[model samples]
Target chain A: MAVTAQTTKLDARKLRADFPIFEQTFHGKPLAFLDSAASSQKPRQMLDAMREFYETSYANVHRGVYQLAERATAALEGSREKVRELLNAPAAREVIFVRNATEGLNLVAYAWGLNNLGPGDIVLVTELEHHSNWVPWQYMAKKTGAEFRMLPLDEHGELDLGALDEAADGGNVKVVATGLVSNSLGTINPVEKLVAWAHERGAIFVCDAAQAAPHMTVDVQALGCDFLAISGHKMCGPSGIGAVWGRAELLERMEPFLLGGHMIRSVRFEGTTWGELPHKFEAGTAPMAEAVGFAAAIDYLHGIGFDAISAHEHELVSYALDRLAEVPGLTTYGPPADRRAGIVSFNFDDIHPHDVAQILDLEGVAIRAGHHCCQPLMQKLGVAATNRASFYLYTLPEEIDQLVDGLHKVKKVFA
Target chain B: MSDGLDSLYREIILDHYKNPRGHGVIESADAEAEGQNPLCGDEVSIYVAFGEDGETIDEVKFSGRGCAISQAATSMLTEMVQGRTATEVATLDKDELLEEIGIPLTPVRLKCAMLGLTTLKVALHKAKGTPLPEGIAGFDELDLK
Candidate 1:
C-alpha cells in the first residue's frame, strides 16, 4: 500500500490470471510484452461482460419494448454513468460515447470547429501531438479558414509555456489542444498548467488522454479542461468504445456529428429534430457490448486503484529507463525522470529501429518500431525512427531484464 | 537461421547491413531514381549505368539512411542487379527479391525494402523513355511532371 515510485513491485501474476494471453509463448519463449502503449491486454471481467451482454441481455435500447431492451437500455446508460464517475464529470450527460478518441476529437473539431473558427481564428496544438490530434485541426483550418499553429517544445519535450502564452495572448485562439502524455516519447505534458493558460485566453482546452488515463487518475473538473478524449483499448477495455467527457454546457452547445437514427428525437421529410447532449453526438446504433466491456474495465481499474496502477507503471518505467541506459549504445528520448509515464522510446547506435525490433523479437521480446504516428515529433527529435519498449500495469521487472538482455544480444550480433 | 527461428536477422543480412555493397555515387550513370519512406523519412537513391543493349545494367550503386532492412535490402539488390540485364532487374518481383534475401518482411518494411527495387526499376524504365506503372502514390506524382 506504501506505493514507492521506483521500488514498488506488482504481482501481475494475479493480473495475468485475469488476461489469458500472458500464459502464451511467442517464438517458443514466454512473451515479453512491451508494446502496451499501442494497446493493453483486457481483463477477464471486460471479456465476460461483452459475452454476457451478447448471450443474455441482447437487445436494441430505447426503441424496443421487450424486457431485454429495458435491460440493454439500463446497461448502456449505466456505462455512461460509470464514465461520468470515472472522470468525475458533473453529470452523466457530459460523457458522450464515440467510436474512439480520434472520432471523439473529430466530433468536437467538426462541431465546435465549424461553428466557432473563422479566417483568423487560431488553434494551438503541441509539437508532440499524434496525427489524430494534429490532423483534425489542420482539416478545421482548411475547412473553416482558421490558422493551425504549434506550441513549441523545449529540449526536454515539454511544451514551451512562453510560446503557448504568446499564441493565446491575443485571445484569437479558439482552442488549445494537447496530449496528456506523448505516445512516442512517453513525455507527460504539464496539462494542468496548460489548461489554466487556455482558460485565461478564453480558449477551450482539449486533452488527448489516450496515454494518460491508463496510468494515472484523471479528474475533468480538477484539470478544468472543457473537453477531454479517452480511448478504452489503451486502458484495459475493448476497442470501438471511447468517451468524450465535456462540460454539460459545452456538450449542449456543440452540434451533433454524423446525423443518423439513434441521435434524433423526431424525424420527417423536412429537417428533423435532434436528441439532447450525449445522444446527439452518438448517431447510430452504438456499440452496446463494447460499452458494457468498457464499464467493466473501469470497475477493474477502480478495484485495483488507479494510484496503484500509476505507481506500479512508474516503477517499471524507471527500472526500464535505468536498465536500458546500461545497454551500451542505447539513447533514450523525451524528458528526465518523473517528467514522463511508463513509455520508453530509445534507439541503438548504428542500428536501425527495424533491426532493433527484429533483434528483440528473436529473444521473444516485443517492441514497436518506426515513427510511432508522430512524424513531426520524429523530425523534432532528430531521429529517422526509434525502437520503443513501452510498459503497463501488468508488466514485470523480469520482462525489462529480457529487453535489456535482448539489447545486449543485438549489440553482440551487430558488433 | 542462427536461432531456429531464422531471424529475419540473418548473418548474411547483418553482413549486408554492415558492409553494404555498391554503396555511394555513380557519376557516369545514365539515369537515377529515388524513393522516400514517408512513415519514417528514410530516403533511397539508386544510380545506374546502362549497357548498349539498353537492358544490361553495367553499373549499379545506391545511397540511403534508413533501417538495416532498407539499407541491407538495398545492398543485396545492388549486388543482385549489378551486371544483370536491366530487363532482368526490372522483372525482379518482390517474392523473388524476398526469396533471394531468404527472409520475410513485415508488410510495411517489405515496402521499404522494395523501394530500392522500385527505384531501380524506375531508373531502368526512365533511361529507356518508357511509361511507368499506374497508382504508385509515392513517386507517380513526381514522375508525372
Candidate 2:
C-alpha cells in the first residue's frame, strides 16, 4: 500500500457527525469531550451493529445446532478475526476474548505468571503502569512467593530503562510487564527495546496496549512481546469486551484460568478435557452483542485509517500544548508533544485538579482529574493528582480552544 | 461564571477558603481527628477543647488542604461548632453546614463538603468515647486516619 497525503489527514469536523453524542449539549453549551483516554464515544455504526445483531442473530454460540446459532457463532468468531487483524497477530485463536483489559492481564498473571514464576523469581514492571497492569503482577508475586520490582521513572516522567541492568542482573527476572503508553502522562514507552531487553534476560514481556492500540498501529510481531492486552471500550467499542493476544506456544502451555460451560471439550465422572486455544480461556457465555459492536468499531477505525487518526491527534496535541503554554502557571507533565500520543496532563497554578475539573465541567468540557489510577507515578511527580485532557479521531481543534478558554476561566475563578 | 458554578463557589465560600476561621491546631486540645477522601486526596483535621462544664465545646479549630468546598466547609464548621455542646455537635445535622455552603453538590463534591463535618463529629465521638452518630449516607466510608 502506497502512503498518500489524503490517507494521512483526518477531517475531524466531518467525523464528528458519525458520533451522535456530539449533538447533545452540556449546561446548554456544546459538549467538548476530552476524556477519550478513559473511554471513547461510540459511533452510530457500532451502536447499530450491536442493536441489529441482538435483534436478528442473537443465539447461544457454538452450542445450538441451528442456523441462527451458526450465524451467531460466525459473527462472534468474525470479531475474533477482526481483533487478530487489529493487533496484527498471526492467528485468530491466539486472541482470547476477556471482560476488559484488566481481566485480560489478570488471566495471564494467574494462568501464566503463577505457573512460570516462583521463589527467587522477579516480576519487574514500570512505574508508569496503570493500577490494572501493576496490581495484578503484585498479586501474582505474592501468590507465588516471587519478588516484585519496578522500573523507576526519570524526571521527565519517562521510564528509566537504564535501571533494568541492575534489576534484571542475576537473570532471575521471570516476567516484565509495562504499558505501551502511560495513561496519565502520555509517555510513549520504548516497548520494542524493552522487549529485546526482557528477552535477553530470558523473561517474557506483557504489553498493556489499553492506551496504545486505540491510537496507533500496534503490530505484535514488531513489538515482539509475549502477551498484549487491549480494551474494546477505549476504541469506540462497547464495554464488557476486550482481548489478550499471546504467543501460541505460551498460551497452549498455560492452564485455563476460568472453567465451566462453553470451554470444555468433554466432561465425565473421572475428568474433563478443555476446549481449544481461545475457548479454553473464555469461559461461560460469550459477549455476543458486544463482540458485534467491537467488530464494527474495528471497521470504523480502519475506515478512518490509523495513519490519519494519529496525524489528526498529533496536530491537536501540538496545538493544545502551544496554546496551553500561553496560560500562566500551567505545568504539563510528560515529554514533549512529539514523544507522546494525544493525551496532555497538567496542573494550573496552585489550583486543585478537582476545582479545575469542576469549572471546566460548567464550561461544557469533560476531562479527567484525580490520580488517574497511577498513584505511584503521582507520588513520584510530587503531586496528589493532575488534570488530563485526551483527544481522539473525532476531537476538534475548536474543542481545544474550549479547553483553553475554560482553563482561563479557572485561573480567573481562583484569582 | 454560570449560575450553578457561582452558587457552588459563592463569594462567602471562597472567602472562607481564602481566610479560614480558626484555621490552626490548639496546643492543648481535648480531642483531635483527621479525615481524608482517598479518591481525590482531600484531607482535613479537627481539634476540639471542651468547656469547664465538660459537655460544651469551648473551642474548635481545623487545618487542611483541599478544594474550595472541603476547606471552606471545614472553616465554616469550625465557627459553627464553637461554644456548642459536644453532644449537640455530635447529633448536629449535615444540612446545617450544607445550607451554609448554599449550593447543591454532586456526590463527589458532596464528600468534599462533608469532610469537615464528618471530621468534627469523629473528634467529638472520640472525645466522648461514644459510637459515631448514624444516618448519614456516604460518610462512613471516608478514611479518618
Candidate 3:
C-alpha cells in the first residue's frame, strides 16, 4: 500500500493547544479522544467566555428593569444571533433554545406534533436517527394515534428512498423527521432530497442536525427543512444548551412546549397569553452561561473556518480508513470515506465491541462502543453493537495512527 | 500487555470466553430466566434442571452474547454452582464471582462481571417459587461503585 503524507489545511497542533484537556495523558499514554460524536472538548476561548459571563454579566434574562439584567439579556440573545448566523436561519426569532438537542427535538414533537397529528396521520422517520430524533416522534405517534413509520436503509446503509414511497403511503404522512447524518454509521444523509420529497407531499420535514451542524456547513434555508435541531456540546461548546430552528410560520402556529414564567405574556385568573416567537418556547430560567459558551464555541469554529475543518477531518478519516484496513478481520460500516463524515464504526472479527473498547482504553484511545443509541440500526446491520472512532477539527492523523496501533494491541490481547 | 488489560482479561477469563462451558440450553428445563443489559444490548439466558431430590442444581447452562467479562464470568459461575443446593447458591454474592474471576473491575464493568450471578440468583428464586432474593438482584442494582 502506498502511504502518502496527506497535506491538511487545519493546523491541528495549534488547535490542540487551545483545548486544555488535550494536555493530559491517560494510562501513561497521550489522550487520543476519538469520541467527538458524543461530545467535543471545549477550547479555552469557550471556557473563558463562560467564566467571564458568570463573573461580570450574570443575571436572569428577560426580567428585571436594572442595567445588569439588560446586559445579561443582551448577551444571551447575542448567542441566539450567533446561532442564527451559524445555521443561516432567516430570523433570530425562529431559533428556540432548549436544554439540548434531545429537548429541542422533543419540543417539536410535543409542541408541533401533539397539535397537528391525530389518527390516520403518519409520522415518518428513518432507521438512521439517534434516540433523540427517533424516540420523540415514536412517543408522539403513540399518544396521538398517528402511524409511525421508519424509512429502511438499503444495502449500502443509505436511506432506501424506494421504501419511502411505500412507507409514506395513503397521502397521510404529516411529518418527516430524520437526522442529517447518522451518528453511528456516519452516513451523510441526503437531507436536501428528503426535504424536497416531504415538501412535495405536503408534509413538514424536521432535521436532526446534531452531527452535521458541528462537522459541516448547515444552512436551514438551503436544506429547506421546516425544523432543525442542534446540540451545543457536540460542537466546541458547553453542554446543557441546544437550539431548535423552525420556520416562523410553523413556530407561530405551535403552542409552547413548557409554560412557565419567561414564556408568558400575562398570567391572569381567566387565562395566560404566550410570549413572542422563540421566547415562547424557552421556558423558565435559560442556561445563560452555557448559551454564551456555545456562542463562543461557534466563534472558535468560525475562526478556523468550516472549510478547513472539513478538509482536515476528511484527511484524518480517509487516513484512518486506510490504516484501519490494515487490521485483520476488521469490518467498517456505512459508505466510503469520501461519502461519509468523520465517524468510523467497525467490529474486529467476532470480538465483542465492549471488549474492544475496554482494551483500547488502556492505550488511551477513547472511542465509543455499543449500540450507539441506534439499536434498530444495529439490528438492521445484523450486529449487537459496534466500536466507533469519530474525529473532529483538532483530531490529528497521529491519533488515528495511535488508534490503529491500539487495534493491533487488541488483536494481541485477544490472540 | 498493560497491567489493567491483563488483570481484566486474564488467561482464564479469555479461555472461558473462547471456549465457554455450559453454553447450551437444557431441553424443557425446570426453571429458566433471561437477563439483559439494556445499556449495551447484552443478553444472557440461564436454564437449570433440579436434581431428583429437587434441591440440588442438577444441570445448569447459559446461552448469550456479550463481552468476554460477561460470558467468562457466567461460565465461571456455572462451574461453581454445580451440585450446590438452591439455598446454598442463593447465598452466592458478586464478590464470590469476582473472586472466581480473580480481577478487580471498574464500576461500569462490574455490571458485566455480575450479570452471571444476577441471572443465576433470579433463575433459582423463580424456580423455587419464592420472591427474588433481596439486594443486587437486577442488573440495575449492581453496585456500580
| TM-score computed on alpha carbons, candidate 1 | 0.92
* Candidate 1 structure quality by residue, lDDT tens digits, A253-293: 87788998889888988878889878888888988999999
Q: Could you report the DockQ of all the candidates, in the order they appear? A: 0.53, 0.64, 0.76
Q: Write the per-residue lDDT of candidate 1 for residues B65-84, one digit (tens) a residue.
A: 88877888889888787778
**Comparing 1 and 2 on DockQ, the stronger one:** 2
- Better candidate number, 1 or 2, judged by TM-score: 2
- Report the alpha-carbon TM-score of model 2 versus the true structure: 0.93
Say which candidate scores most in DockQ: 3
List residue ranges in candidate 3 displaced over 4 A.
A1-8, B133-145
Q: What is the per-residue lDDT of model 3 for residues A1-415, given as tens digits with 9 covering 90 to 100?
A: 1112233477989899999998899999999999999999999999999999999999998888999999999999999999999998999999999888899999999999999999989999898889899999999999999999999999888999888889977759999999998899889999999999899888999999999888888999899999999999999999999999999999999999998878998999999999998889988999999999999999888877787777877788899889999899999999888888899999999999899999999999999989999988999989889999999998988899898899998999888
lDDT at position A136, candidate 1: 94
Clashing pairs in 2: none
TM-score of each: 0.92, 0.93, 0.95
Error of 3 at B120 (Å): 2.7
Ranked candidates, highest lDDT first: 2, 3, 1
